[model samples]
Target: MPDIVFKSVPFSKEDVTLALESGVDGIITDAAHVDGVRTLALCDVWAEADMPSVALGSKAEEESIAARIASGERLVLAQGWEIIPVENLLAQPAVAGKLAVEAASLTEARLAAGILECGVPTIVVLPEALSSLKSIVAELKLSQGALSLGKATVTEVRTVGLGHRVCVDTLTLMERGQGMLIGNSSAFTFLVHAETEHNEYVAARPFRINAGGVHAYAVMPGDKTCYVGELRSGDEVLIVNADGRTSLATVGRIKTEVRPMLMISAEMETPDGVRSGAVFLQNAETIRLVRSDGTPVSVVALRPGDEIVCRADVAGRHFGMRVQENIREI
Candidate 1:
C-alpha cells in the first residue's frame, strides 16, 4: 500500500480531522499545529519547515533530488510532475523509498502510484482533495493483486468422525465461484468453495465458508496464513475467485462446533513430482470444494479422481508467517 500524507498547510482543523479519520499515514503541517493534530490522533507529523521542495521537470533536477534523497532528505516533488521523470526516479535503486509527490487530485495520485508499475511509495495529497481521501486510500489499499492457483486431483475423501469445524462468516457477499484457500499444510491449500449455491436442504449462504478443522491454514493477506481457530471478528482474510484473483474481506463471525469431519486428500503435479496434501472439513452437504471449471462440489458428494482448484508452494510456514524450511505435513 502507498503511504498517504495530508498537506494541512493553510491549516484547516476539519481537513486534519478528516485525514485522521481517513487513516492517512502522515500529516504535513506547521510545527505550531503538530500538537493539535496529535491531540486529535496519533500519526507521523512532518513540519512544513522541514520539507524541501524539488522542481522535477528535467532529468538534471531529478538527479539533484536523488542526491539529496541519498543523503537522507525526504524531499517532496512539486505538483505537475510528469510521468517520465517519476518513472526515471523510480527506476533508480537508491530512490526506492526516499521520495514523495504532491498530488492535487485523485488522478495525479493514481498516476504517481502507477509509475513504472511500482509507483512512488508516498504521496502528499493537498487539502483540497481531502474530501476524496477516503476513496483514494481505499483504492490504494484494497488492491489484492493476483494469486498463483494450480490444479489438484482428489485421491481420497472419507469421514473422520466428529470433530470441531470452523465456519468463517465474512462481511462481503462472495460470488458463485469465490471462496477461501485452506488446507492442513501451508504449502498446499484447497479452494473450499463458499456456501453460495442453494441446495434442497439448506439455503444459500453467500457470506459463509464452512472452512475446515481448527488446525487448517487459511490464506491471509501478504501471502500469509492463519489457523482457522485464530480468525476472529474484524480480522481480514483473502477471498479468492476461481480465476485466482483475490480481494480482502473482513471476518464478521466465526462458528466452531463439533461436527462430523471429512478428510480430503489430493495430489498436485509439480515440476519435481506429484505432491499431496489433505484438508479436514465438516462432513455436511453445505460444505463444498471448487472444481476446475468453477463448479462447487459438496464434500459429501465428492469422489476420487475429481479435479479441484488448489495452490501449492514449497516454502513452509512458522506461526502463520512464511519461512524457509524442509518441513512436510500430511
Candidate 2:
C-alpha cells in the first residue's frame, strides 16, 4: 500500500519514519503538498523505498499530467470527473496510474474493465462496488491478499508470530491476509472499518462514519483493503461485525442481471421455514424461491423455507450483512 497525503495538511517525517518502521508500501498525493520544505520531504525520502508516488489531478480538466513528473510525484490518480483520453493516460510514463470510477453499480464495474482494457493499471471502485466483491475479484484477477502498514516502510527481514520471518515494505502483510493499512493521522470523520466480520476486509483500526451513514470505506470505496482468497460460486463468505462476531453467506450463484447488479443466488434453509411466500418484496430486500408450482415466491417479510436470489448489484447496494452463521472470510 502507498502513503497518501492530502493538500493543506500538517504531517511529520518522524511519524512517516515510524510508518516505515511499521510497514507501509507506498505514498499517494498531489503537487500541492509535495512542494513544501516541511517534514513530508523526509516522508518517503529514501529512493530505494518501495514507496510509489501517485499524483492527483487538481481539477477534472487540468491538462497538467506532467505536474506529478515536475513535482516528483510518481503515481497519479486520474480525477474521476477528468476527461483524459486513453492516449493521454498512456502517454505519461513517469507514473504508474490508477483511475477513479466511483462505482455505485455493475455498470461501473463493466465500464471499469473497459477502462482497464484502455490501459489504466488500477481502478478504484466506490462503496457501491463492495457488494460485487466476487465479481470484481474475478474481473480484476486479484488472487493475493494484502496487508497495510499505517505509516512505515521496511527493507529487511522482520520476525513475527513463530520464528516466521517476513519482509516489510512500507506496508506488510502475509500476502494472503485480507487486511487494510490506513495512512494519514487526521480527519476522524472519514475513517472506515468493516461493518461486520463477513465484510470483504477486516480493519486495521477504527474508521469514522459520518452523519450521512457513509464511512471512509464507503466514501473512497476504491481506496480499500484488498480481497484475499479464490473467488468462486458456493464459497461461504464471512463478514465481521463491529463487535467482531462474523456473519455468514453461501455463494449460491453468480450471474449478470441488470447492467450494474450481479445477481447472487443464495439459498437459506431455516429450521422452521419462516418467511416463505411473503409479498411486497422490493428490489434489494426481495428474495425469490422456487415453489412447487415452479413460480418464484417473494420473501418480502421474514419467513422460513423461503429461498431467494440475493441480488449483489455492483452498481451499489447493501451487500455486506455478516449477520449469519457459517459465513466466509474475505
Candidate 3:
C-alpha cells in the first residue's frame, strides 16, 4: 500500500470523494477537525474509500486514544504509544517492566519493528514532523509496506476461524437454558425463590433454576462459557448448560422469599465424639471465606471435604466475602 500524508482542509462530502480519487491512504489533521470529521462519519466514509484514518492530537492521552479507537479511528500518533499525555507509559511498572524485546522505540524503524512484532498493526499520528524520531519512523513505513500482503492473509484465516467458533458456542448456550440451576450463590445453600422458582431436570439430572428479583440468577446456556451471576433489574441474562446450549431470561420482581446461600451439612468423624459439622453463612458479599494465612478461594467451590476459613472484606467499596484455603486442605 502507498503511504499518502494528508493535511487539514475544509473537508466536505466532495472533499472526501476527491481524496479517495487522489489516492490518499490516510488523513492527518489537528484535533480541532476531529468533531466535524466525525460528524461526517469520517471513519466509515474512509473505509468506503478503502482507507483507514488516524486521529492526531497535539498530545495523545489514554482517554482520547480510547475514544478514537471506539470511534473507528485507527492509528494514533503521539510521543509514543506508551507515552500518553497525562501518564508516562514508562513510569508504569507494568509497561516498563515488560521484557525489553517487546519495547518499541520512538523512531520510525523501531516503531515499524514494534508493529511487526505486534503483528502488522496501524499507527496514527499527526501531520507535524518530529526531528528526533524521523529515521525510525521511515523504517516503520518501509516495514509496513513490505509485510502488508502476508499479514492480511494471516488475519483473514484467524478471523474466519474465530467467527465460526463463536457462532457455535452461542447457539449451544441458548439451547441449554431450558433446565439448569443457573445461579449466583453463597456457601450455605444455592439461593432460590421457593414459590416462583423450583428445581427441574434435563436428561434426569436435577437442576434448580430461579428467575427472581429485579436481579435474577442464571448461567450461560452453553458449555463453553461459565459465568454465574445475578441479573440486575431490566437486565438480560443468558443461561447456558453443560452442552454449550444457551437460553435468555428476563428478570422480574422476586416472587417469593430468596435464600442467600447453599447450605451443606455433614457429620465429621473426629478423634473425639462425632461432631455435627455444619456451617451457616450468607453469600459472598457477607462473609468471604479465606485461608487462615489469608488466601482466597472460590465461594462456589466449597465442598463437603474441603477445609476453609472466612474473611471480612470489601471490593469496589462494597462488602463481600473472601475465601481462603484451610491448613488441612493445603
Candidate 4:
C-alpha cells in the first residue's frame, strides 16, 4: 500500500479537514500552515516549499531524479512527468520507497500506485481532487493484488456427520461472487461463496460467509493465512471475487456451531501434474462455491466433473506464512 498525502497549499481549512477525515497519510501545506494542520491531527505534515519538485521533461532530468532517489533522497514529482519517465524511475535499481507523485485525480492516483505492481511510495493529491479523495483512499488502501484463480473439477462431496463449522461475519456486505478462500492447505484453496442469496427458508445475511470447518485455512491480506478456528472479532480477512480481485474486510464476529459437515474434494491440472485439494464446509443450502461462470454452486448440488474456481500454489506454509522448503502435505 502507498501513502496518500493531500495537498492543501494556500491553506483551505475545509480542504484540510476533508483530508484529515478521509484518512490521508499526510497533508502537504505551506510552511505557515504546518502548525495549523498539526493542530487538526497528529498526521504527518510536509512543508511543501521544503521538498524538491522536479519535472522530468527530458532524459537528463529523469536521470538526475533517479540518481537523487538512488542516493536516498525523497523527491516529489512535479507536474508534466510522463508515464515513460515514471516507469524509467521505477525501473532504476535501489529507487524503491523514495519517490512521490502528485496525482490530479483518482484515476491518475490509481495508475501511479499500481505501476509495476509496486507504485510510488507516496501519492500527493491536489485539493482540486477533493471530491475524489475518499474514493482514492478506499481503493489504494483497501485493494490487494489480483489473485490467480483457476478451475478445479469436483471429484467428491460426502457428508461427515456432526462437526464444528465457522461462520465468518464480516463488517462489509459481500456480493454474489465475493467470499473467502479456504482449504485444508494454504497452497490449494477453494473460493467459499458468502451467504448473500436469500431463499424461502432463510433471509439474506449478505455480510456472512458460513465459511467452512474450524480447521480450514483462509487466505488473508498481506500474503498471510489464518485458520478459521483461530479467527476473532476485529481481525482482517481478504474478500475475493470470482474475477480474482481482492479487498480487505474486518471480521465482525466468528460463529462456531456444531452442524452436519460435508467434505468437498477437487482436482486440477498443475505443472507438477494433477494435484488434489479439499475443504470441509457445513452441509447446508447456503454453503456454496464459485463456478466457472461466476455463479455460486451449492455444496449439496456439487457433483463429479463440476468445475469450480480454486487457487494452487507451492505447498508450504509455516505458521500461516508461505515458506519454501522440502515439505510434503498429505
Best by the TM-score measure: 4
- Which predicted model would earn the best lDDT? 4
Off by over 4 Å in 4: 13-23, 30-75, 82-98, 114-117
Estimate the TM-score of every prediction. 0.74, 0.24, 0.22, 0.82
- The worst-scoring run of ten residues by lDDT in candidate 1 lies at 137-146
Superposition TM-score, candidate 1 onto the true structure: 0.74
Model 3 TM-score relative to the real fold: 0.22
Error of 2 at 135 (Å): 1.4
Q: For candidate 2, lDDT tens digit of each residue in 69-185? A: 445644334324333443365556654353323334545445544553453444443333334544553334331222111111111111112111111111111111111211111
Residue 98, candidate 3: C-alpha displacement in angstroms: 21
Displacement of the residue 320 alpha carbon in candidate 1, Å? 2.5
RMSD values for the candidates in order, in angstroms, are 4.4, 20.2, 18.8, 3.4
Error of 4 at 64 (Å): 9.1
TM-score: model 4 vs. ground truth = 0.82
Off by over 4 Å in 1: 4-54, 58-76, 82-98, 102-111, 114-118, 124-139
Poorly placed runs, candidate 2 (over 4 Å): 1-61, 69-71, 74-86, 96-102, 116-118, 142-330
Error of 4 at 141 (Å): 2.0
Please provide, for model 4 over 132-231, each residue's C-alpha lDDT reduced to its tens digit, 9 standing for 90 to 100: 9999998998888699999899999999899999999999989999999999888899999999988899998999999888989999898989999999
Summarize candidate 3's per-residue lDDT along 30-115 as a digit string, tens digits: 44555555564344223212223323344444445445444554433333333233133223344322211111233442443343
Arranged by lDDT with the best first, the candidates are 4, 1, 3, 2
Worst window of 10 by summed lDDT in candidate 3: 148-157
